[model samples]
Structure formats: structure tokens, C-alpha cells
Target: MNYEKRGGGSRSLPARVGRRLWVTAATALVLTAAVYTLSVRTVTGQRWENAVLAGRRQDETLAAARDANHMLDHVTVSSLGAAVAMLMLIGLARRRPALTAVAVGTVGIPLLLAEVLKRYVLSRPELVDAPARLSGNSFPSGHTTIAMSVLFGLALVVPYRLRGIAVGVCALWAISVGAYTVAAGWHRPSDTIGADLLVLAVACALAGLLARTGRVRPATERPSPLSALFLAPLCLVTLGGLGGGSLLLLESVVRLSPADPAVPRLAYAGGHALAAGASAAVTVVLLASLHRIDLDDPAASP
Candidate 1:
């Protein structure tokens, strides 16, 4: 969470860029807020709403979205985005006091749009049962937009040496919002992706305008050792077989007739456990090597 300054001088080239990004976020906040407020009008006859409910899986999709709803457990990314914005504001307090001014100036639009959208749009899945706290047009997902406004917006403040990583982090966070929204059945793929792009466009425009200048850095990554390991046919078949075998076992259990009492209920727990382990192992290894900030570590020097 901390970075050792790469070089020291009177706000070197990189520092200047960071300053500019903060400035851009400040200004863009106001403009995007204005646009969000002006753009959230409702359509007649529920055209978009009807389209989302189309298909045989319509009832199932609506049900899944309802099932996916949880108070705070699943309502994530929204808070994460706010926390990140708060941190940026705190960090930029001193040298970039103007950044604070910008944050203050434009905090109203996203909030206002979220509320307006909630009231104007009338197709929330939960509302189908009966109106609850969350209802209205979900044309643009709130969680997805927050992800863009905060993470993608912060990309400008990221050091050029680390901008790529910053952008990837932002993307991952944005994608997570898509997963949450779609899994919750609160938004269609079209809704979430569209919201994500609009947010990114606004963020980029603001970040770019404030950017005094830009520079490109080269990537010099070495291939990981595990590529050869995973490339083996045995490894591929083992991984695939484990996954398929686990699903087949589960399917067999699910399809068994209720009258057939002889079918062992938990026989494939062992197979399922094995498949889970294989998946976890692969994820753990990939995540462990994603980055190596050790080059900047004081002890890493010869």
C-alpha cells in the first residue's frame, strides 16, 4: 500500500502528472455529475424492461436476481469505491488542496442520479413481488458506476511506472461489479457493461483534460515457470477431468428419483472436494506471482 519514491527532486515529472490527475478528477466530478442528472429520464411502455424479461429463462433470471440480493454481504464494490475516493481525497489534502475543492464541488451528481434513477425507473426485480427499499429503473448499475468513478478515475493519480497495474486493478474492480450486479439479477449484461463504459468515458475525459502531459512505459515481463507445468497434456486432462467428473457426480445425485431411497446422498462429496482443491491451487499460484514490487525493496538491492 506504500510506494518508495522512485527518484527525488522538486516534484519531478511523475509527481507533476499525479498532480494533474488529481486536478482532473476534481473537475470531471462536477461535469459527470451534471450529465448523470440530465440523462436519467425514463422511457415509456417499459421497452427496455420488457426486453430484459424476454426468453424462457425470464422467470429464472428474475428469480436469480432476487435470490442474489443481500443487505451488505453482496452489496459490495459500492463501499469499496467510496473508501478509495475518501483515501485519495485525504492523500491529496496538502500539496493538492485544490483537489479537495474539486471533490467537494462535484460530490452531488452521482448521489443525485442514483436517487433519481431509483425513483424514475420502475422495473426493479424486488418490486415485482412488491415495492421494497430498492426499486426503479436500473438502466445503469450504481455499483458499476461507482467502480468506474473511483478506481478508473484514480488511474490518473497512479504513478506512470505503475499505471498499467493501476488500470488492471480498476478493471478487476469494475468486472467484480458486473459479477455482483448480474449474479444478483439486478442488471442485465447490457445494463452493467453500458454503465461501466459510460463511467470510464467520463473518467478518462476528466483525467485526460487535467493531465499536463502523458508518457508511455515499456513492459518487461518474464514468463512464469508454471506455464511448462500446465502445458502438459496430463495436467490439462487432469484439470478438465476433475471438473467434469465432479459435475457429473452432482448431476447424477440431482437427477435421482425421490422414490429411489437407495441412492447415497453424499457419495460424491469426496470428488467435489478434490475438484475444488484443484481449482483453488491454480488460482493461488496465479495470484501469488501477479506482481513483484520487491525491486523497490531496500533489501532487494545488491
Candidate 2:
């Protein structure tokens, strides 16, 4: 129970948690701002984003669009409500009311923030001559936020032993949702990336709150090595492959004129890769942060 001695450090748990929270929040803010600036505030950024949208040729992305739409269709308000309720039920079943509240905040706060930003705070100027539909403000995709928030909520509420498995499963789904938004043309890659960053910031803030409340504790049980062995490689591969691939594709098209027929197709593929990679990266970071912290405080539980 002596956390101070266990970590081989003089700083308390709250201090450590506070430091992480600040670092994560600052990083998220900077990244979010960068995404908005590059993708919405500049002509080149607009051209690139618009190219991705235009590149969604029916012959190329039809199957992807179909699958993406099918996945996105389940992100209605009712479905999200039910998902939140299910996460709460899991927390209650584990006898962690405080954790349950944190889980709810983790899911709800980001969605609310995304809505406000998209509707009022953020704007997409006519940086380039693009279709009205493509120019509308959708900086942060609501569907992506919902997917990530649900993933974070579930990660918080699940048992420590099963945390790895739960996160692995849910992270895949969340990554898919982000990529799908791009493929379906419902959102730009920036929107999904922004949503991922927003959810990550909120998640870190909520985790710090839990630490301040003394709701976080050291896990009594040892985590399985299988999760580390499996998830580490999976995350690394996904992050490296997709992120690298996206960069390569974008780089290849950078010198090409926008009028080139290949630009749109390459941009669209790059955007899809970027969206999925960003989601996976965020999910991996969240899981790493929660590695040894137990959300349930047994002493505080009934």
C-alpha cells in the first residue's frame, strides 16, 4: 500500500499524475491547434483536404464506404447513451462508484466539447474553391469522439486483469471508426485527428481528477504478460505501418500538381492511413498511462 516506496520515487502519486496530465493536455492542445491551422486555415491545407474528399472515387472506396457507413450508423445518440449506461453498469458491478462517475465524464465531456467546437468555436473558411459540403465546419468528428470516449470509458471501468484485452478490442474498433470517417467522406482526416486529441486531453484530465480524489490505487493483481506481448506489437505495427505509409504517400504527391489525376487518390489513401494511425496512437498512449493504476479504490468502495 506504500505507493511512494513502490515507485522508487519521492514524489507522491498526485504529483506524478498531475505532471502527466499537464504534459498530455499541453500536447493535445498544441496538436489540435496544428491540425486546425494546417487543415482549415491555409490554402495548401485546404487543397490537400479537398483532394482527399474528391479522391473518394466510387470505384475505389465503395466497399470501404459501405463498411464505414455501417459502422458509423451505430453511433446514434441512443446507441451512445446505451454504451455509456453499459460502462456505468460495469463500474457499479465492480463496486466503484467514483470510477463510474469518472467513466461517465470521460465519455460525455468530450462529446459535448466536440459539438460546441464544431458548431461555434471552430470554422472552416473558404481557403480554396471547394464544394460547400466540403467547406462546412466539421473540424472534430462527433462519431470519432464517441468511439474514442467509449473506448476510454470502457478502459477505466474494466477490471485490471482484463484491461489489456478490453482495450485491444475497443481500440481496434475506435481506430476503424476514425479511418472509416475519412473513407466514408463524412469527415476529413483532420476532424478525426482533432477528435482523437480532444478525447485524449479530456481523458487525461479525468484521470488526474481521479488521482486527486484518491480514487486511483495500485492494482492488487498482476497484469498478464500476454497483453503486453500481443498489444505492444500490434500497436507498434499499426502505428508504424499506417503512419509511415501515410507520410510516404503524402510525400510522393507533394511535388505533383493538384490537377494531376493521381493526387486525389493518393491523398485519400494517405488521409485514411493517418486517421487510423492517429487513433491507434492515442489509444496506445491511454493504455500505457493506465498501465499500473487501478481505477477502483477498494477501501472507498461499499
Candidate 3:
């Protein structure tokens, strides 16, 4: 009976991990391909270009309060390198070697891929109706990728008790960066969306790999401290989405064209905001779901 119990229980863990790895890899590949196609092809269309252009030019209507470009300017390669180094230090301080490795792969692979895609794999096509559009490729916004990856990575290494708060903060940070890029004209909505999807795919793949390797096996655990803190951000995201969507609908009803300028720009900016909120919600959900699986928390919601 002892021998039978030992063999069966030992094999089950690997079998489960193998299944999760296969599923995660397949899903990630499909999502990455789909986002790549949309970003590279569909978003270059006149409609999308005009909407994005309007959003990018919203500051023109508002005149001078703040320079949106400031955010993108500071998110340079050097800044990202420093941020990564800081994150590594934090992970080491916690003495979680395996979790730190997972965090690095989750963030590092996506960062590398974002740069590669931006520099080589993708290109922004010329816009016919939107002749004033900015020149250069911007399929995957590097800033958004960096922000999201950092947040996601940090969430993975944080203690189980603090995971919920980390997830919430990460979601807010990612959304802010993504929205800022769209408003600053550094990237179109599709670029930021694609960046989020890409980061998510890489994070999931890395998580699955770690699980399969038995390097970061999930252990049954207590619920995180202040789990309710996570709910507030998710609620805020929902409200923001609803408000933005309503504004968009009103703009459409009023027949505000890109030619008129101000109203359309307002609508476009609202759309960008909505996208940010949606992306945040998705990120939060993903983190929560993964946390439940990783910690073996039976009380976690779907």
C-alpha cells in the first residue's frame, strides 16, 4: 500500500504540470499570432488610423497643461535596465530564488521580443485618409511592454500574502503607461493592446514552464492578506469602461466626424481610456487566476 501510494502520487504532479505546460504554450502561440496580425495589418486601415490620430492630437484641443511626450521620453532603454536590476535586487532580498527566476523570464523574454518586433518584424503602413500621421513603425509599444512586464514580474515574486495588492497595483501601472502612449502619439491603440497581449503570453508561458520543471510548485496556502484591495481596482476598471463606452456611443450618435476635430478628438481620447481600462481588467483577472493556481487556493474565484 505504501509503494502504491508513493508511485501514484509522485507521477500525478508531473502529469498535471505537463498538461498545464502544453495548454499554456498552445494558447500563448495562438494569442501572439492573432495580435501580431491585427497590429501589423488591420490597425493600419484608414478608420483605425484616423481614430488614433484624433486621440493623439487631443492635447491640441486642450492647449497647454502637460506634455504627454514626457512619459514616453523617460522610458528609455537605460531606465528599463535600471528597473530590472532593482527588481532583481528585491527578489534576492526576499530569498525566493525560484520565483525570481520565473519573474525574470516573464519580464525579460517579453521585453526582448517587443524590441525585436518593433525594429524588424513589424512596420506601419502609409495612411491614405490620415496623411498627417506620424512616420515609423509602432506596432508594439515598447513603453507599454516594459511597464506591463515589470508589473507582471513583480507580482510573481511577491509573497503570497501580498500578491493581491501587487496584482492590483500592477494593473493600474500597466494601464497608465498604455494610455499615456496612446495620448502622446507614440503608439496607436492597437500597438498598446498588442503589447499587453504579448507580455501576457510570455508571462503565462514562463509560469507554465516553471510549474513543469517543478521549480515553483504550487502549495496549498492561506488567502492573501487584504485580498479585498484587489477588488477595488477591478471595480474602478469596470466603471471606467462603462463611462468611456457611453461617451463613445454619444459621440457616434452626434455624428462627430474627424473633420470637425475637437469633439472627435475627445471621443478618441475616451476610446483610448476605455482600452486602457479594459487592458487593466484583463491583466488583473489573469494575475488573480494565476495566483489561485500557483498557491493552490481553493477559495479563489474564476
Candidate 4:
């Protein structure tokens, strides 16, 4: 059942695919959350919107300035941000070998599971108030889920030296996205919360598995102090935000660049596929390289 293929010389290709699956899950979760909220609003009638929606709850921030146009925000908010933390922990796992196992296992297994759940269970997003441009099913917030997984996944592996800061940053990013989604009228507040919880559950289960693998201590015994200070949580969020922001900027640049109307469709799709593939490839490489840094260069160890 362990889909995690052991690395022979370095990380196996399965590992790379498995890692990419993690980001895919994260990306898919946001779309899925959007879809789920629409369905919930249609059927359930005001699940989270009527109650917990902080943005709509009191936001009143809609102005002529227009909402922020953030597409790859999910990449930074969910994957890039958590990825750095998860990878950082993986690096630390060398000293805490058990944690290293947890990091890889958590990042690997549930990633696959999240995808299957998205395709079969969720409905696509479509509503009058919802963003017209979006096209995908949503049950759980893929973005929220991925964000939680990366941050919480770290809780399973980080040394006592860095647990508080790790969790704090993770929570901040997820919360910001959740708030923005509600404010942007993209999803009901409850849907986002549910997705966040789902990711936490997935992450915790993965952590437990790693513990069973003798990678880290048990949850009850894992004395992770609640160090999520207001300012402290802001630490790694910039990394993800910047990555996503940069990609968006590149997209703008691409749009401004000279176009090829000769073969528009193929080039457009190819360009997108290339970008997605590249973003995903870089994410995996960065994650794996971060993990292997100490092993590849001993002096780098803390």
C-alpha cells in the first residue's frame, strides 16, 4: 500500500511524481472548495456564509480598486509556502532521522488520495455570484488542504528548535487565503474551513504513519508548543506569496509579449502545459534538494 518508492541512488522518479502529486492536490483543493461551496449554498442554503464568513461577515472592503487578481496564489499559498517548511523539516530529519521519514511519507501518500477524492466526490463550481472564469469541481478546498498539509506535516518532523514558528506561519497563510476566498465571494466560509480541517486530518494521519515507521514521536507525546504568535506566523508566507506573485507577473509579461496568431491554440496550451510542468518540476526539485542538502554537503547541517 505504500506507494512511496525507495530511492536507489537519489530520489526515484516515483518520488518526483509523488511529490508533484502533493502540489496537484493542493491546487485541486482550492477549485474543489469553490465547487463544494456552490453546491452547499444551492442545497444546504447558507452553510458558512451566514455565520463564519469573516470577509463578507464584516469585510465591506469592496471598492472601485477591484479585488486582487491572484491566480497562482494557490501555488504560493498552499504548495510553495508549505513546501519550504516541509522540505526544511526533511532536511532536519537527517539529525532526527525519524522526522525525515515522516516528511517524505506525508508528502507522498495522501497526495495521491486527495486527487482521487476530488475527481469522484466533488462537483464543479458554478454560481451566479461565483467567479465565472473558474471551471472545476470542489468538495474540499485544495489550496486550504495543501497549505494545512505542508504546515502540519512539518509539525510531525521539525526539531523542537523550530516547531512554533513553523506552525504559526502555516496557519497564517491558510487563514489569509480562507479569508480572501470568502471576501472575493469565491466560496462560503464554511467550505474553506472544512477544507482546512480535511487537510489537517490528512496531514495528522500521515504524521501518525511516520511515527509508526519510527520516524517521529507519537502525537500525544510530540510536545509541539502552541507557538503561533501573530507576527511569527508571517515568517515563510512571503516565500509562497512571492513565488505565486512572480509567476503571475510572468503571466502578465507573457501576455504582453508578441503573440503568434498563426497557431494560437496549440501554442497557448503548450505554453500553459510547459509552465505548469516547470512550476511543478521546480517545486519537486527544490523539495528534494532541500532534503538532500546535508547528505550531499555535510557542512550544511545545523
lDDT winner? 2
Lowest lDDT sum, 10 consecutive residues, model 4, at 292-301
Per residue, candidate 4 scores C-alpha lDDT tens digits across 151-227 of 54564455544555564555555455544554454544334445554554445444333323333211222323455
lDDT of 3 by residue, 1-302 (tens): 22125535533554465466556556655765675575456533435445555655654544321445666677777878886787688678876566677787777898889889888877666544455545557777788888888877877777666777777766666677787777766776667777777877777676666556544334446556676677577667757864775577366436556566555566666657655875675576455446444521222221
lDDT (CA) per prediction:
0.39, 0.81, 0.64, 0.42
TM-score of 2: 0.92
In the predicted model 3, the residue pairs found to clash are none
Q: In model 1, state the lDDT of residue 75.
A: 43
TM-score per prediction, in order, is 0.41, 0.92, 0.78, 0.47
| Runs with alpha carbons beyond 4 Å of true place in candidate 3 | 1-29, 58-67, 242-263, 295-302
* Candidate 2 lDDT for residue 191: 96
Clash totals, every prediction: 4, 0, 0, 9
Report how far off residue 216 is in candidate 1 (Å): 13
List residue ranges in candidate 2 displaced over 4 A: 8-11, 58-61, 300-302
Clashing pairs in 4: 29-141, 29-142, 30-142, 30-143, 32-138, 32-139, 36-138, 98-215, 124-137
- List model 1 lDDT by residue over 1-302, tens digit each: 21234334322433354354445445444543443343232331122222222311333455544554542154455675575567366537433433333332223244345546546742334313312322345655676555445554444343334544544444444445544554454554334443443444344333333332322111134434443343343244336534664564455345433354322222222222222333222222222322221111112111
